[model samples]
Target: MVALTGTMGEIPPGGTSREFGTAYFDGAEWWAVIRGKPIMARWLDPIQPLQGGKIVVDFTTDGKGLSSALVIGGYTDQPRPSTGIAQEVIPAGLATTIVFIGSDGVTYTTDRFIGSYSPGDPIYLTWDAATPTIIGKIQSQATPPPAPPPPPPPAVVTGTETLLVTASDTWGVGGWGRWAKSQNGGEYVYSGFWAGQTLTGSWFYGAPRPALQGKTITAIKFWIPAREPVGSNNAAATIHICAHTSSARPGGDVARVVGPFDVVVDPGFQGGYVNLPLTFGPTLAAGGGISIAGDPYIGFLSRLKDPQVGKLIMDWSA
Candidate 1:
């Protein structure tokens, strides 16, 4: 069916009162199809079959909104089937006229714009001798091919190092937090080492020193300092503070630091020691412990005996 628009005298007097397009008709339905908008066509009377050439088609509207019309111009003398439905054998090539009226009171005709049509391709048609509307989908075209298979997903890579301290030093999951007296550092295994042996250590609280409250510490004191590599063969180290007395959460970057410590490779230096001052910011809580849990082999500290102490300071709201 077609749609009509515009006001009455809208059509210029001598100018083209209105413009219409081609039409199409399926075996059972009639439609007036246009390119962009809808055109309206009303049938004042039933369509009567013509004996020879042309047929008279009449229809009218208030002319409020007038667009192009879909005129059903050909196939007036075609015989109707026993069911009284308009029937015609559409030609193999060239534009053809196919017309039919739907139960909705709209006439549809095929203008056969392009020479031939396969199934699925839409064919334009119009009914009411006026502008024809695109009725429905053509039944001749083949169905579309199935969609392509989805692409494969990406792969995940896993490593073996256990002393995994994330790259940040803030205070929560990615930051530093409060430490408790009896805390066990996180569990990790040494996979590969640039240098030095793999050893495990946990975090324990030292005798509470008032000056240590609210300050941040990067090193913990061992009952006995262990031998470790220095400079070239230094071991990677990490530190974690427990949020709860029994829990050791991995601290951010600010929680751990590494430097050269003297190893007892030479016996002459009776119990040589390496100490790194646990000074960075004011981040540790008073009476809370410090933990130095990482690879502690010989010669790992750059600056020996500098003494690392835990300190606590203020942090902005997370």
Candidate 2:
């Protein structure tokens, strides 16, 4: 048995492979008596090595018993260690040692040795007793996804509407001379003779009701009758429908003359009335009055004794 005292010598920084101690056993014929029996022995003092020291023990049948070799201050094939610093400070006395292990299984020692470290400071180290290295720092963070694209703009909406306006003479009684009736009471006439005088006439203006407010007038239609029986006195004349601001007859003008439509007396009289349609660009507002006027020779058919003078048809949109 060996009794060890004092330091066996400081483990070198790199390492040294050398035999430290040895043991022996007698293998002659006298030892055969105890070969099959169990033998146990104990050491009075335990072996302790400084940091980085590696001790290896071997047994050989060639006569050597327990032999030990020391690899002083060496690295092992182990994974490198990484940690955040707890504190970092210059050493007041002996400098501390730290080590680092590379991914290629090579150990590296750091040059700097501090007494302390700090939290959040990144540390890369190895199992070797080399100086610990500070690589960087770490911080916690969170990032949100990009905001969704803005919603598409709302779509525009548009449509169309129509207004049909018919003239009425119900506002008064005796001014019905503008309207005429056949002597036989067959059908009413407009701008025709009644009781021997030729009637030149104007009809009451037609305007949009409250329901048709804010609409636009797009077209106008005139329904006038051809001279009866295709007579020779039937002449061509100009017809007009004017727009005004007031409902009263011949009020302030909004659109002075909407039309001066020419009409020819139908020589055949195949149909009693003809429809004259006039279209306008864009449109006109529904805020005003519409009145009908014409040359004396042009006449419109009227309803019998109904007090309605003329029909003014309007096509509109809103």
Candidate 3:
């Protein structure tokens, strides 16, 4: 990644595999910078919008017409607290657009936080132009969809929908015990799916998201099904639920921090649901799924059966 002000990175020593570019940590590890293509994009939905971060900008020398987007880098407004003048003066480095993978499998880019927009507002996406990263601003440039040929009454809105995770969750085996099926014919870890128990690593996924492919998520709720025998690490514990986007395991750094939730024993004590009430929290990306793991990497277990399959509640709109 080059500086946002257009500084070039140095070439590596002759025999190394590293590319001539920059890298930044995503809170978990250093990421080899990938530049953005200077593509003009159109924002789509989840009915949610974007907030900015490291931009995926086109690094090609032919880059043109991009100076107009670096309105907000978040640090320049330092001492006084507000970027009151950033809207007028562009920063010293080049700022590109933040990246988001579309449900259609195409990558789209926009500035950090995009407010409310309709169907086709254009997202001018670029990446990697500053020390940390630069984000290009999104502008509304597309024609709105043709207004419905109307004589019909407008349809009323409905409440959100929920998705459940009953059996064969994407979560796999715990090191201590092998797989055993309950009466419902679903598989669960017999011993415990706690940390240090697995050589493979442990991070449990609760929601069933294949159906909510294109819809935006408003909330994520989880349930730890009842276990006849409460085991170690089974008592009330706090785990950080995170939103992950790429191939690697969810590390210290994640696209969105969904925040901490306490997994406590319910009043009945059979099993527990996430204890804290989620009146409000972060908005997750469309088509993206969350992972349940602990801070400092503690122990966690998930052994469930029917009537209480690995339950995941998701609230979202069409």
Candidate 4:
């Protein structure tokens, strides 16, 4: 059987030209008959089997164009199928050609057509011998599952706290008023030994105040009075702040040691109590009481006090 199919431009208002052809026939045998009159015909062939072929013609109309139609009328020596349809599965990324004999004793072909596709893609092609066209459609397959939801963000912990002077103790002193002094109008622990007198005096210790527990101390501020005893030139003292395991006086330094910050009493008792600020490393634990030790130089104030009224600032997540 022969088949013919092709696209055509829109017919003009007056008329338009169209053509068709096949490779099976010689040019001399082709003819165009209109109203019982023989008209000249053009044959574009000598084409290979299953290859495209064509015939050319220009039509003249009386202000009316031809209607869309398909005409199949031919005689062949060999018998052909009356009607035929075929289906084929084409894989992705492959170009293929489809050829089949039609009911009109003509061989039809869809020369090398490619359907660019992704992995696992399949194209369903349906060929109709009457239309002489192979229509292709992508097969329906399961859609990939949606990407797994992004992992949840890590949990965050946040809080706030404060470090306050909980409890204060004076080292090397028996009675309260004896080894204590008033500084900035607040009672503070004092070391009341003059310079070179066995170097004896009092030290101060501070722990978290009541109602403020589990607070991390970030910084501390205190006051110390430096006095120049008679006949002494610049009397200096070294203050040490150590982190202890407990609130008692003799606990070991489990957390850290701050410093031996020096306090100088110039000649003639030139300096008053100086304000000292110490920032802790990574914030001291409130459970570990901070120990304060003082080592005084000759003529340095021994009876002076170290204030326990310092701010113990802490931080927590809200």
Candidate 5:
């Protein structure tokens, strides 16, 4: 039996079509077998088999996972099957074609898909050629599951928190960004401490800070005393606020917690406890540190105390 792709079209002028695969017969002699049975041989072309034309086959689908009808090429000269029912079954989860041979030797098929067919079991196929339309049986009868429950409300901020976390001034995510002096007074972290920048900067870089565990950070405050702008050059800084989980040095990518604002110092730079707003910031886990960084020639204050009071602030909830 030849395998057919089940699609067809007409041959163009001065040309032949090969859609028939190997199905053909010259002068009314179709010579092909399907499902181990000889099919009617009809004249498709005037010349040899599969020469001037091709056989056409097409199909249509029905419900979920099922096919309804199939259009088969004609093969004349053989008596039409009187049984009116034919089945071609495949493996499980495969569709079995139920063929109905019409009185004119034309074969049409409607398929009943096996959803979970068992192996070694015979598939039933009973169809009438006169009425090839058969509504497939309901393959599955299992009831659907219930919908899921809704999520709980979000946690609200109840109070405030303030802590002096170590600050650092680093050019990038590279080594501690020039951590020197003391880890306690190393609250100043500068983002401008590259090879060319001078060490006269006023930032601190040291070990990570205490974790604000379960506390939602609101802002980080820093101190910048009044200084001479003549040596400032109207310079600005991009402060990178972070919350790290490491005890060593904090990296930007792994611990950044929001507020990375830009600040420019003009002539009358009011030096006070400047807050890097962390509104709607993330919660700090255990062992988390806070730090900042900026561009070249900019210094950030860190680790504030009662006198200086430059520190990290947050909103705490139960």
Candidate 6:
């Protein structure tokens, strides 16, 4: 560890060590302080993003340095009701250093919460600017391909090619699932993949994007297949599906369900077929065409989890 003395705190060696609340390096050496008192030094780890813009962060600390539990609180637009903003009180003075993590990566060293006078209550560290040690040997990895270019246009304009969707491993774990298009087809597209059990019965997707202000679609239909080995969570197989329209851009989407059709049945795992009734509205067209799509993609939430599999068969004849 390259030791140094600075205004932050006492520094220590760097790496992927969980030395939270323990000695850490802040350009120079300076001990970590808890509640204005010097305690074991610990460094805060950066946070990572989850689906839907959520995040998670963590840090470890040696329990011996602080007097009381480590306080964790922050300010948010959704302020806490009366009493006080909810704070996490981690037991302090542990044999192993304690760690603190957050959903966002904003640096905060001040008390970001509002509470009555309580000496031990946790608040942001205003006295000392939070010192985050530079550590971890992270390698920059390549980003996955963009949501497979929207599903390609249908072979011909038989009826209305209203809906098209595709999904997969790249679009997070819960690949698209439970898609429905109207019997009066116009045009549509969606794409994605599944990796686990997911309930996407309510997810909506489409093509005649929001840009298509107002238009009317005639009808739409999908011939999605499900097999015995592929209907539920503990199924014997997995599946992928995509859909789209005749617009300049294609449409794509995907989704899955775990089933043998059991209590824990898969949505598209059985060999037969399913008819997801679809409803449409005036905004079918994005101020241009007449088409709409809903539940374009839905399914498993995590790649580690099991996902449903099957083919999507669409028809405009209805």
Could you tell which candidate, 1 or 2, scores higher by lDDT?
2
Question: Model 3, stretches more than 4 Å misplaced?
Answer: 1-156, 166-186, 189-216, 227-235, 243-260, 266-268, 272-290, 295-304
Q: Please write out the lDDT profile of model 5 over residues 1-318, one tens digit for every residue.
A: 133223212222333223232343456666444333334434334423342223443323332333321224533345433222223334334455554333333445555433333322222333332234433332344222223356678767566655443443333333444444224344443444545543322232233234455555545565543432332536543344444444344343235444454555555554566665554244233444444444444443333422342344555554
Clashes of each: 93, 13, 27, 22, 13, 114
Q: Which stretches of candidate 1 lie over 4 Å from their true place?
A: 1-199, 206-211, 214-275, 278-318
Model 5 bad stretches (over 4 Å): 1-157, 166-188, 193-259, 267-270, 275-280, 283-287, 301-309
What TM-scores do the predictions have? 0.18, 0.32, 0.31, 0.32, 0.33, 0.19
Report every candidate's CA lDDT. 0.32, 0.37, 0.35, 0.37, 0.40, 0.27
lDDT of 2 by residue, 1-318 (tens): 122211123333333323333222344311101113212222223433233232233211222233233222223355344533323343345654444333333444454633344422334442323344545433443122234477897664333333322333211113433333433432334443334544433333445355335545455554343333311345444445444344434322233344444445544332233344333212223434344444443444444433333344555455
Task: Give the per-residue lDDT digits (tens) of candidate 4, residues 1-318.
Answer: 111111223445556445434322344554443333334443334312221222234443343433332223322345434332222333434445555334343445554334433333323333332233434424465333234477798665444444444444343333322332323323343333443322222233345443334433333443333443433244344445444444433432233345434544445543343433334423244345444444443322332233224333444321
1-318: candidate 3 lDDT, tens digit per residue:
233333322222221111122234455543333343122222222111123333322232223423222112222222221111111222234453334333223334344433332333333332233221223324434332234364777554434545343223223342212333321333342322444432111223443345555554566565555543433444443445544442233333234345444454433345555632343122332333344444322322343434444445666555
Summing lDDT over every window of 10 consecutive residues in candidate 5, give the lowest-scoring window.
1-10
RMSD (Cα, Å) for all candidates, in order, is: 20.3, 31.4, 24.4, 25.7, 21.5, 26.0
Score candidate 2 by TM-score against the native: 0.32
> In model 4, how many backbone clashes occur?
22
Task: State the lDDT at 263 in candidate 2.
Answer: 49
Off by over 4 Å in 6: 1-158, 166-215, 225-273, 278-318
Error of 1 at 122 (Å): 99
The numbered model that scores best in TM-score is 5
Query: What order do you get sorting by lDDT, best first?
Result: 5, 4, 2, 3, 1, 6
| Model 6: per-residue Cα lDDT over 98-132, one tens digit each | 12232232222222322322322222321112332
